[model samples]
Target: MTETVAEAVARRRQYIAGGTMSINRAIGPAKLFVRAKGAYIWDAEGNAYIDYHAGFAPYLFGHGDKDIDDAVIAAIGSGASLIGAGTMPWEAEIAEMLVEAVPGLEQIQLTSTGSEAVSYALRLARAATGRDTVVVMQGGYNGWSDYVSYNLMDPGDVVADHREGDEYPLRVTTAGIPKVIDTTVRVIEYNDLAAAERVLARGDVAALILEPVLQNVGVVKPLPGYLEGLRELCDRYGTVLIFDEVKTGFRHALGGYQAIAGVRPDLCTFGKAVANGYPMGVVGGRREIMALCNDPDPGRRVIIAGTYNGHPVNVAAARASLLRLKARERDVYSELERLGARMQAGIEAIFARRNYPTTFVRQGSAFALYFMDHAPRNWRDIALHNDNERDLAYRRAMIEAGVFHFPAATKQSSISLAHTDDDIDRTLALTEDVVRTLG
Candidate 1:
């Protein structure tokens, strides 16, 4: 080991905000990673770990993918990334590919990050519908925007009652957000059709936004008829429907969960694995709504402008990655599901043997281990029922045992195409021992 982890944390704190960029802090000081490759990462101290964190689920093919890296390098060498200038030909090519892959996407607007993409989606909805209020799902993370920042998975007692008599107040997660911001956004429980109906029926909501599958706090799945109900409600109320797929976009499926659910949102935001960890985001949806941005009148149009809107290097990476996924969609997605199921069965076996009541929830490659016996429906249930202390201890044990699952409780762990049967077996063995030691 070159330096103590404490020393590394202290040094990082000197520059980085809160010693890290994400609010989901580790149980202990954050590990300083230096290098990575397929399915594994090396810490600054040169400790090798099988990486379940997987760069927050963006490394779909795993870190240091040759094709994606080569594409980025080639784009840079070709001088295509001249920054803040003419549109690259590959931009339209990538957009075309996305439209073909993702259902209900007729047009796409590019952005540098998912947060920015969601902001653009919201503004487009506001412009098209001529409404101001937004309805969001509890525990759904729509990035750090003021519009979607409220009701994020917080460390403490974060979930609050959405309705108090005649009024609903915003549950601000961060401090700097104004109290008035609450009035613009309404929070509803995911998978609760009645709550969604109650909120959307008001007809004031410009957009009803949520993750089709809640990934921010342990992949809470949408119950049957839940998403379809939202779609119907949004149509009835003249509101735009948005699916914030930053986490679930390309990781679970190239077409996303919407393709599987057979329910489409009017607008959808994509990022994370879209560029295989390259900085890129895409907001795509119906042509009727997205055309609002192209409105000729300068004052009435929705502005979808950004300096890095379609950076050639990032677009190249994304195009190559998506092409790879498209080329091997059957093999890639099937392998991920196979590996994920194997890991899920192994974890459940450990808990069953240990007599620990746990709920292991998964959809495709993303999974979570909750100490609660039942499947949690939303953030409130997760807060009241899931044992954070036990989950934190389990994650800490994984960290010490050469398995790098992220530290925060209820955060989903990912399986990548780079992860093979051998990796899952090794992780299962380590997890068994960790569960044994918890007594």
Candidate 2:
């Protein structure tokens, strides 16, 4: 007797309930993946699905690239762990590549995850400036840490109703964060220069952290001159401008959004695509700002030290990934843009023909479907989604039709160098069919 798919799913759910760190509201019966190669993944029951999320936008070379795998194997054979050592040779190589690729990155500090990198960057900014207040953009997500989670509006709507003038200034998204942490965080609207200026003029801001391209809520592109204006404001006010390029770094272009947009930030945080699926993060910036980490007086400044700051295996993977990006930069970006445009156009046509109240937002190779009348410019606009049920229904239908994506409804589908014309065509066709069925 063979167990059904439902039974397997139920068993998985039981395992999850037994004890697992529950982050997102993952479905009880998640699809159990057995293997993945190139652009497709196979489930435990040997069903294949075309993966569109690209491992949350990190596997730009696609799943199971032989070059990266070989590099990882070589590094492992040599020795994998050197947690608190002097330096791994590959770490220097990655750092050199990063500084050379990104114009604003004069020096960098490596970390194990995007969250740690971001937290460290914020701490550096505060130490360098001697200011405690951090002004975060309305919808930008830096990490899950307390210092940066004050104002993550679903659609760019800050819950001002819950605020009183200077009375316990911090608002915690989760329970573990102390209420007093709010005093160090100030929330402002993205792309709104007037609102941002009002806050920056307060003289207490140590840094202005934002995702140049918002990837979590939706792929919201920055408005014309918005990033440039912000750069100028930060400079004028002596605030450190930190671009959270974890998602947009290697995806948009070889140098990331800063290169494409032609705006230089004081500091930038990168992860996700840097190691091509390996756990790695980097915080880099002007030499002066980064030097604070090495300040002789430990008691006078912030200290950042991570156990897995630049693991040998991860560094090797990053070096290999960066080499691939450098070698095929033009072809990779062009193909992704072309294929993404085709998919977006096809999806838009489907929505138009069926008269569905849906809009697609795209930037370069990343795209997302928002159940709204128009593309969202900020978090507030995204928060206006009317039908989460329908959104989930469409996502489930797409998955059932053999298209895999991040389970989050707000996720953006990332196009990879390995995705071909046929992959794009199939994805569009399946999406069209799914939209029709939804209608």
Candidate 3:
């Protein structure tokens, strides 16, 4: 007999810590999905919803994409899953593709997860600069590692004392992070050039890592000259600038957002859509920095070892995903923009007709709708103005109306390549109805 949702959730918690692998998944009502295809997922109870969450924004070409799956199948059929020895041909092929696609990346090493890649990036920066301190944006998230896991969505009170153009006190997201670790991580506000310079001026910072577009706080964009300003500051301070592009890498553009922003960092890390949801992470950037991973001087080498770093299947998937994006670069990105605009416009109209104040922000296929009237410039802007309860209510209502948006405030809604004009229309119609009831 098939287990019910409750039974399944219970079974999960019975063995897994916190009843789930990621505690964030435990938020909201218990939901157990049984299957997914292009544009949609079916819950165990057989309800279908157009998936805007896209499994946390990884399904660029869409869930179960045929070409990518075929590549994985081919790789598995070749009986070369894991050599556990010397490097293979698929590794070089994928690495070459990555180097060609990303604008600022000169050398790269693979890891099994984005968190691992981020960990390596931090290590490389510290090793290269011979400094222990790292500066991170207050609201930016760069994986779950201890080095960069502070101040993600902290409580308002925790950040209430924070002043504009200043840094927030260390608010670690989880416990078990060493207290000594707090001294090494410095927090600063996003889009604040003065505050960044103040922090970096201390002259002890090893790296300044951040997402080009702050997706962690619902797509807060960099103010004009903000990224360039940070670039200049890092150059002046001798700090290694690292852009964590795990979310905005392949989903926005093949070269990552750095390519579009025209500001290159000393290092960049990528995952998520890099393999279209396959487990792959990349840490790469300027050759001099990346060379630390295998430095001729043993003391300087930043060791990045994983038995499954470049698994053959995942490499095949990454190669296939990148090739498809490269081949249809024009068509794919244009279509994504069209769909994003359509979704944004329709939602804007629905809220406008309701006279409900809302702000819709988009960057290519990724977008967010905040209950605030104006676009937020930073996480504090969002924390002060955006309506958390209403935003969560709207997302829950939409989920019930057959549109899945991850039922969380300030989280982004993604649009996949498989999402069609009809899907957009249906979602809009559903949005109109959902908004009507929200009153």
Writing each residue's lDDT as its tens digit, candidate 2 over 222-242 gives 889989989998989989999
Off by over 4 Å in 2: 1-22, 80-83, 155-170
Worst 10 residues of 3 by lDDT: 153-162
Q: Of the candidates numbered 1 and 2, which has the greater TM-score value?
A: 1
- Tell me how far the alpha carbon of residue 21 in candidate 2 is from the true structure, in angstroms, after superposition: 4.8
Candidate 3, residue 267: Cα displacement in angstroms equals: 0.4
How high a TM-score does candidate 3 get?
A: 0.98
Distance from true position, residue 47, model 3, in Å? 0.1
Worst ten-residue run, lDDT, model 2?
160-169
For residue 344, what is the lDDT in candidate 3?
Answer: 92
Query: Per-residue CA lDDT of candidate 1, range 308-336, in tens?
Result: 78888889989999999999999899999
Instruction: List residue ranges in candidate 3 displaced over 4 A.
Output: none
Per-residue lDDT of candidate 3, residues 1-439 (tens digit): 9899889988898899988778767757788888999999999999999999988888998999999999999999999778778878787878889999998889999988889998989999999999999998887889889998898877777667788778887888888999999999999889889899999999999999999999977899999999999999999999999999999998888899998999999999999898988999999999998888778889998898999999988888998999999999989889999999999999888888766689999999999999999999888888888899999999999998999998889998889999999999999999999999988
RMSD of 2: 3.0
Report clash pairs, candidate 1.
Answer: none
TM agreement with the true structure for every prediction:
0.95, 0.92, 0.98
